[model samples]
Target: MNSAQLKIHLLCRGIQLDSSVDLDADARPILRTRGGLASGIEGILPGGLSINIPVYESFAADSPFSLVKKEEKYYVFRDEEELSEIVLPPNPKFYSKKTSSGKLMSRIGVMQGTYLGIYPTDICEFWKTDPPSNCRFCSVGLNLGSTEDIDKTDADLLETTLAAMQEEKITFVHFNAGYLGGKELEILEHYIELIKKNTPLMVGLQAAPSADYSIYERLKKKGVDHLSFCIELFDEERLKEVCPGKSRTIGRKQYLDTIEACSKIFMRGRVSGEIIAGLEPAEKTIEAIDYFAKMGVVSTVCIFRPLIGTQYENLPSPKPEDMIPIFQHLYRTTLYNRIPLGMAPNIKVSIVMLAEEGRGLIEKKGFRLRLCEMRNSFIKFFISLYFKIRIRYGKIRLGL
Candidate 1:
């Protein structure tokens, strides 16, 4: 294969391999391939490549990697190959600690691997009325059903989140609750209030769009460092089909409008939207990313991974090769525009690299000076154009 075809093949291979195991030995090849390196390429690199892998890996684990528990051992496998095996992270010290009110800390919330995740409420009116209204990619109902308790109070969540931060050295806190239908705004406010009263750490919240701007202002005041209101799709018709619940509840135009309003309020870098790559037309996603970039909202493009018990379980996921160009373009645009790094706190290294290159242009003299200035001013614009042409000719490539 030529370099272009080779690049595509490598990306495809990266996407095809599932790397959800905890051990580095099992995940390295998938990481190398995703980074556009030869599968066996050995070396250390810079920047925040490790962070992006988790979101995609989370999706991959649900679809491809199967976890089996036999007797005392937990094993992760892909088909017949036993990739890696290990015991789960020890329950944190805080799990055994409880609030003065007597709620179990673990039941309120817990640290999963590296993330501080909380499901304060497991009931969504959307799920109750019509399951299809839910995002096609989400397994919220399945997760809720498998777990015993249905609701966790705001006070309990606050206590647990605070304990995790203080005792576990946790840096980020992520919380998502079930959609409350007519009570969406009110319940969200309760969560924001509780989190603010309890912790000073960076916090993220995900919920269906709300009708009131005041609630958003309250959340911002409550110390919400980042916000993700996922549209899930750029195409209107696709939204109707893939997220019927969200579409009917929030409406397509309202969702986009809310994102626009959020960009204005949260300002660039603090605001973000999620786009499921495999579900929508690639061109539509490109358009959406560019549109969001101009609006100062970071677009997080995640590959579609069919969840085990979801409605789409029997459907196939988009091949990794097809997702490479899109991911590359998205990352390049994000870097060039200086989008705030959101959850990936480690992305500062890459931003510093781009900033230094921009500064280098300003220091050059004569024709070089003018050329560098032009490059510096339109870094994102140029990168977008470059990727557009490269992808059109099937030459797009990424080095992680």
Candidate 2:
């Protein structure tokens, strides 16, 4: 199977690792902090397709796929049959390094694919309410303070970011905090500025939307390269049911409005609307994608993984066949809209299927798709050049 297809299948049906596969010795640890959505074995499929395969989820126990090491090389197997060879992203020694504040760098920030992901604030307030109103599929509450530090100082964030950039040669530093009252953006701004001020690495923030649209503009000025608004469900009622805190506090209209506002502020692909596919109907998910596409906002579609301790732990993961259409639509819409995907250099996000990666799911691509790719190639060149200039000059903001 192709790399993207393998990525989709592995995401839908979690994979089991053979006992011989020592992740600690050979791979990046399953650092399951930051929204608790991911806790999986990470591997890079051929052609640079990096993925986080679910390994610890209950569904993974019976996965048809398994990772086995043979002759010191790792390969995924189907039962006893070898399927494909894979390599684990190295467990970087920087993870063991400590920030200036004595906090372990791994606890402060961990690599999610090629970028350093940091949840530099307290746990989402949704998980701390009287009865707990967290997202049904989120494990951030259980994950924070257990695998990573709960509250990371600005120094910790800067330290971890610099270490990852220096050692991993990372291109971006992503900061995602769970809901923090209405102050999520306000709280994130400090770290965003800190990172921008010190390093050449690009910054992306995924937080509960700010009540004020202007906060995004200020953040862009401060140096947020990208912004992701998790409007998890498109269907209003499903959103209410699945993300009670988001629906009540931020509201469905507000999320879309914020996304719309940012689209005008940032470049086409730089603004993303993240939606969890399995929670809402596939049709709704498509509508959500189209909505974002029309506004020049790329959709960051995350497959609904039934995280272990979340409220939806017992839920079944979506089948790969069922999700195929959703992703196929993802590639077509993004390409047709002329929104560039995979333009940023060395960014391979494993948590969800990227718009560009959806190319593998589509059975056919006509000249139209080819033309878009060609146009995107020029854009990618310019983007790479821009990043080079930014890294050298430091503190250059997107003219958007």
Candidate 3:
């Protein structure tokens, strides 16, 4: 399909999609369209869209493209027929087991779509005060405050994680913790060590930079496959305004320094930095991506989605058109450097599709325009979802 046609198809599909209750506003609609539950696109295509299911075994009986029903039947929909199917991954016998502390092992960590996401600590230090010092994009602290007994001790986390590995065939395990008072990074190290000691699964850790090199050494010893020091933004002035607590705790240079140090330890193609798109000027984002690429770090460009209770709630998301070019540039740079798209699986999936279609053709100096169409599709899906939910829910208040 032509780039223009592909962009239009993606936007239309994204807008008409439906979702399950648990999916975030944006993902729900996209899931619906993907599942063939939503309407439109009857005549435009030659025999409907093709869905490729990633092969992995899990207790969950549903295919990636289909949803499981309450009646214990798998539902698969196509343009002409819907089929009742049975697709099963060997049930991890360990899933039925509990931790020594009597916590349900399954509840300790969750599989969000495809990724195994675990929260070591649900509380952030910044949330303890008025006008909390947490990052503007985070809702972890607020969510933790609303719930009782949110903390997952290091032992329990490790035990449950081990059980998950034994029971579920997880491809990657992602560990994210709330900002601990002063020991956030330290606590993360403990969990990392335990996981390293126990399993050989791919591990990705996200946290602010630590105070010392020893922590990095400890992490390396524990077998961290990927590391993300989320600097979040590149504009120094904007960094101060948006993430004052982070700015004070770890300055931009220090954050960059940490990534450099980690890159040295982890080596190129293994270290990454996170940059939230739509938060700073296009130039700033471009500069950060180029800088990270030069330093052998993959720049994970996340679209700035304002969480329900964060400070930037009223702000509008950057239009997809605005972010498409930026994504294309970064994707092409990484491709040129032979950097495997690190830990950001979803973005990699989309970009790979674009690359496969020979969209990496247009060039303005060093930047390419081929991936923009696909990038814009992702952006449109997210923005449309963001606005729809905001309008319906009217500022979601996490019961903090």
Candidate 4:
């Protein structure tokens, strides 16, 4: 089916299918969505957007679309009619490797499309706060110690990162940690420095805004190519209600200020502020997109999934019809401001809304989208060229 419809279905009701770990139908060593909600695996849609659909015990048994494996290949079927061929990203070659300390390489990181994703720390301080202020929609607290080691070493990160680069040809790595305050930044920097020293992958950090803004400068010095502050909601009151710990500590003003400041340091598409759409008024989300675009930062939006076991698990996801306009607004705002649609093929991750908009830019070819694409391509080309030169010549040697 169409990109919008497919994305909406995946966001609202994950597909009801299952993959065997031992079979090619199973795309293992892949990123799990929404803190391992026992749904679908992350994969590339036929149109080239990264998506994770429901496959195991999904709520949408009645959904017209179902994933089926026929002769080792996976296909999306609509009532016994094939809709599209699906590509399950293969298990990375690095998954079999072990570090010097004998840690499984796959345990250190997982591939989300082409980007190697590492969760530096799963423990969030907010879980232990006197008032229990973790974000209502987040599952980081529930996942602590259950999925990954609470503390990982730099050696583990460095070895795992280089293996991904060498074996899987990954050019980017994203490090995520729940709120550990300054300690979180330290964990990220530790890995960033190690990975930059050992491999050529472009690094991205997802963490809370540091209390000291100067941490941004330090991270840049350590070779963090990109940064994201996940301010999940935009409206001041709703943000406080939904993300009590984040709003209490960083707040909307501080989040925006940090995003703006990091945008100045990283410039344009390199800095991103994550907004969870369908949580607040769509207009507020639109307003947040506008604000991020004007400052030349990527406004990465994820459709609100009421992930199981979280405080808001019972709340329903927003209607797919409602999210269509929000995605359209995001497209227009980012295009008008001349920011890139995504970080490019390898560096981008599978967030549904961004993928839908990227699909629109490719398929729709409307005047505004075409112009935005031209601008986006122009910028992306230069960025790619700059990195190419730096990799070969030891620095950017061009005068332009």
Candidate 5:
């Protein structure tokens, strides 16, 4: 099977760990994200397909696929047949270093794939309410304060990012916050500015959509490179049932309107509308991909992983067959709309199958799509080189 199919299968039907495997010594230390995915082993398959395979989920214990080490080399097997050699993300040496404020850099910002993912605020307010309106599929409240530090200072964040850039050679820093009563942008703006003025690293943010669209323009003007709004599910009724706090406080229309407004502000492929694929039907997920593509926003889909402490913990994970069509549509819709993709240099996300990586899932390509692919490949080279040069220069000069 191709890498894309392998990715889907491993994600759906998780792999088991052989007795010979010592994850603590060999793998990226699994940190359960408050975003509720990616609490697993970070492995890269052939052709640069990076994935965070489910290692902690209950379903992983009874899988056909398994991992074992041979002569210090990592390999994944399916039913006692070796399928492919696996490459693990090297555990960062800088994780042991500390910030100027005496906080461990790893506690301040953790690497999610190639980017530095920092949650710079306290818990989402939904989880703090008396009734607790947190999303049924989210584990933000459960994971925060226990797994990582909360309310990190801006100085602490900058110190951590610098350590990561200097040691790990990172190109991007992503800052996301929980709902701050409409002040997420306000609270994060200073942190964003410090990174923009001090480093050439590309900046990205994800939070609930702002009530005021002008805040997004301010963020863009401050050199924020990308912005994503998590809408969770496309079916409004299902969304209401699943994300009660969001639906009651911020209507579904607000997410769409905010996404459309920001799409025009940021260039195409710079804005994304995020949705979970398995919670709603595949058709709904396809509709969302089409909707985002039309609005000049790339759709970021996360397959629903039933995180251990979330309300949906007892629920079943989505099957691989069920998810193949959803991601296949992501490739088609993004390309059909002429959105530039695979332009960011070395931003490989382990948690989800990237839209660009979906190229492997398609069996046939039409002549028009072939032309589009060629154009994108050509664009990717120059654009990536530009960033590479900027990053190299920035390491010495320090700003874009």
Candidate 6:
């Protein structure tokens, strides 16, 4: 297989064999068995490509690939043949330190590619409710009392963020929390302001869409550069079944409206709706991508891997081949709508497919792919001109 194709295959299939850990290597402790299974080895390849693949436990031992270390260098091998030289992302210097509140810096925030991911809240409120509502595929609810700490103060977050920026050169911060209410937004706003005021890093926040539209404005004012709502399903019935709390509270229309409204406020390419690839049918997933793309919202696809502790733990992961068409559809739709892939540079992370990889696959096979690239170029140029004019003249007030 070609290199791009092989990497995509491995990402979807997951690495089979594992690598030994060296605590003395001065790398970030690879977190295993956490909320999203965000802990794993960061694999760097040719063409500046990188991915955060799971190497913990079964994910390492059950897949078709392996990451082996020899002579202090990491390489990815498939069926005993080396594909490319790789590097495990370095552990941030701040991770070894402690926040002012005595919280371990690593506990406060974890690195996801170029972005520092901070989960401010440990558990989803829906899971805490008597009826106990949560996304069936989510592991956050399962991790609440065990792996995650419930109380992470704003001060702890700020101190950790500052250290990450200074030591790791991370320019982006993604603030995530479970299904908390306005209180979560308030907390996020406070942290956003603190980080914006103190450092040059841009910040992003992902949470349930609030019923109040004004909260979006407040968030933008707080200097949140990008915003996201994790509406994991697109099919009406499936959404209700998969995300009971969201369905019962806001309903599908409100969720869609919230995303559209956020896009209006955040502008095209700045807002995203996260949808898992495996939970629903491929057609519905493609439809969601089209729907979001038309609204100028980027679709962040999280390939469904059944984390061990979640409700769907027994469900098999979608085959790597199954994702090819889904990703192709996403790439074509986003290009048609002129929305850029990925949040920013150096920010490729595990949960979503990198836009570059998708574009590479599309470009490698010319035909309609060539047409898509031409259209993408035209759309990109016009969009760039629009933004430049908007900024240069300051003709309109964005309140940002």
Which candidate tops lDDT? 5
Per-residue error for 353 in candidate 2, Å, reads 1.4
Task: Give candidate 2 regions above 4 Å deviation.
Answer: 392-400
Candidate 2's residue-wise lDDT over 1-400, tens digit each? 7888888889999998778988878998887857566888878888788888998889998899999988899998888887788989889888888888898999988888888888888888898887888888988888887898987887887777777877887888898888877887888888888887778778899987765888887888887889998888899999889888879988999888888888998989999999998887899999999999999999999999998878898999998887889988988898889998887778888788888888877777799988887888888899888887766555334211
TM-score of 5: 0.97
lDDT-based ranking, best first?
5, 2, 6, 4, 1, 3
Q: TM-score of each candidate?
A: 0.65, 0.96, 0.64, 0.88, 0.97, 0.86
Stretches off by above 4 angstroms in model 4 are 18-25, 29-39, 56-58, 343-345, 359-366, 385-400
Which scores greater on TM-score, model 4 or model 5? 5
- Report the C-alpha lDDT of model 5 over 266-353, residue by residue, as the tens digit: 9999998889988988999999999999988999988888887789977888999999988888998898898889898989887888
lDDT of 4 by residue, 1-400 (tens): 5755676666666655634223343676433433323234666766676676644332465466667787877777777787777777777777778888887777677776667878877577788898789888777666546544555678888778767766666678888877787578876777788778766557888888875778889888888888888888889999989988888877788888888888888767778889888889889988888888889887878787766677887776677677777777777777778776554445545544563253453345678777777877777787777766554442122111
lDDT of each: 0.54, 0.85, 0.53, 0.70, 0.86, 0.71
Model 1 per-residue lDDT tens digits across residues 1-400: 2222222222232223334433333222211111011122111122111111222432343444344444545444456665444243344677667766786666566453344666666566666773246666566665553432356666677667767765665555666665676565566667776665545445677677776777788788877767777788899999999878778778878778888888888967677777777788799888888888888887766556554456765566566556655655565565566663333321221101111222221222466444534554465455445534533332112111
Arranged by TM-score with the best first, the candidates are 5, 2, 4, 6, 1, 3
Task: Write model 6 residue lDDT over 133-198, tens digit each, in one string.
Answer: 777777777654454456788788878886776666666788887767546777677778877776
lDDT of 3 by residue, 102-150 (tens): 7665556654333356766656666665767767766565444232236
Q: Which whole-number lDDT from 0 to 100 does residue 184 have in model 6?
A: 74
Candidate 4, lDDT over the whole model: 0.70
> Cα miss at 24, model 2 (Å)?
2.2
lDDT of 1 at 223: 74
